[model samples]
Target: MSGKQDCKTRYPLLLAHGLGVTEHGGLYVPWGRVPDVLRAHGAEVCFGGQDAWGSIETGAAQLAEAVRKIRHLYGCERVNIIAHSKGGLEARHLISAMGYGKYVASLTMLSTPNRGSRVAELLLHARPGVAVWARGNDAWWRQGGDKHPDALRAGEQLTPAYLEIFNRTHPDACCVYYQSWGARLGKHNTDAAMRLTHGLFYPAHGDSDGLVTPQSARWGRYRGTLTGVSHQQLVDAQGVDSGGFDVRGFYVRLVQELVQMGF
Candidate 1:
């Protein structure tokens, strides 16, 4: 049930990154480490232009545009999406709101905040300093609309309003299967920076992935939880030197699954 075969050969993968990150097509985590593995197995990767820290809608639009460009470049009609964190939300919106499902094959989300993050909520109210910092970033302003109030409002609730819209439009798009995975920090040693950030932004969901809770990361349907993997660890924990669980095997397994599923 995949889309046109030509598209698969031209743009085999569309890798979308989470917020506060660059979209210059560099490898990040799991993608950084595993993408090559997939390529070795005959996969072509592309970038889904991501916002530095934009709203879900804005990011989704950028992703859709990227997909369109990929399609045009490759002369294919469909592509697969591999998104991380908030990137997952953007990918979902592309399929639903932007009518990209017709051109998509599969969507694989890793450690995404699908149900909204208590951390983001807390930051909306507690951290005036961070908000000011976020304002200076072009990506943030693009996604948040150049106003703290708007950003706060948009992130206030993972409201039924947003969820209902996405569910209605994307509830199983043709030939596009939605899948997700989440991880936890377990201990402060996983990432001292993340530990400090989590303490400040989301003290409630202790042992979370700095920005999102394990529960919020579970989107669409239950796949399986990767125990002991941190938010960043889910990508590539090779020899780069980082704390938390060893996710090398996890990345291998996930890429293997995507290949087996014909992503």
Candidate 2:
């Protein structure tokens, strides 16, 4: 029941991670146990090894290579990509600008800020001192990612000013189908960290998944929001152990939709 073959898409699945996360180590997994769960459900899964905090162009290039590798290994023409957070931007970049559309069957984004989030815009303008934390985080972000410690710059890129330019330049691929999923913590605080982000993002952006509001996250075939699920709980496998939302089951349903779409 937990690991049923509910997501056997025609193409294999590629799981992409978000910002400030590196696809490494048991403890450092991006999609966490979702990979294992998908594999258990008879779907082949690969990880997109893009940098956590690199420029979109840079990260997408890395994703291009990862897609190539997946194609070679599976001996398949394309793979279905499920990306989270900034990885969704990288996925779009690959398909739209980097000549990767032909190698991607479908793109499913979870909690991606497609229209850009005001949270990132405000963070950069406020110029709060995240330097000390970023220094440590950048170490992992730079691992096979980008060179500079670019936390603040990454925030700038996630603003509408930048994404508007990005949408124009990297318009959707005619051959690829796009869809998205999003979530939100209950209005009442559940997780302290997510609560802080909810207060910050909701006022400016309306209901949000802690960091991204529904307005910014909506793209292509928008799936309805997952109530009571925070941005962190959206992807963190540890949440399953903590009696949180059924992360594994949620993905089972998401990927099953792709299977139904013939991807």
> Best-fitting candidate, measured by TM-score?
2
Tell me the TM-score of model 2: 0.88
Q: Report lDDT per candidate.
A: 0.64, 0.78
lDDT of 2 by residue, 134-240 (tens): 66667765665555546666777899889898888988888899988887777553567777877866677667877887667788889878777777677763445
TM-score of each prediction = 0.76, 0.88
User: How close is each model in CA RMSD to the real structure?
Assistant: 5.7, 2.9
Question: Which pairs of residues clash in candidate 2, taking residues 3 or more apart in a chain or in different chains?
Answer: none
Please give the lDDT score for candidate 2.
0.78
lDDT digits (tens) for residues 110-170 of candidate 1? 8887766766655555557755654555454555442222344345434334555555656
Which portions of model 1 miss their true places by more than 4 Å?
1-11, 24-31, 127-131, 139-170, 201-203, 237-249
Candidate 1 vs. true structure, TM-score: 0.76
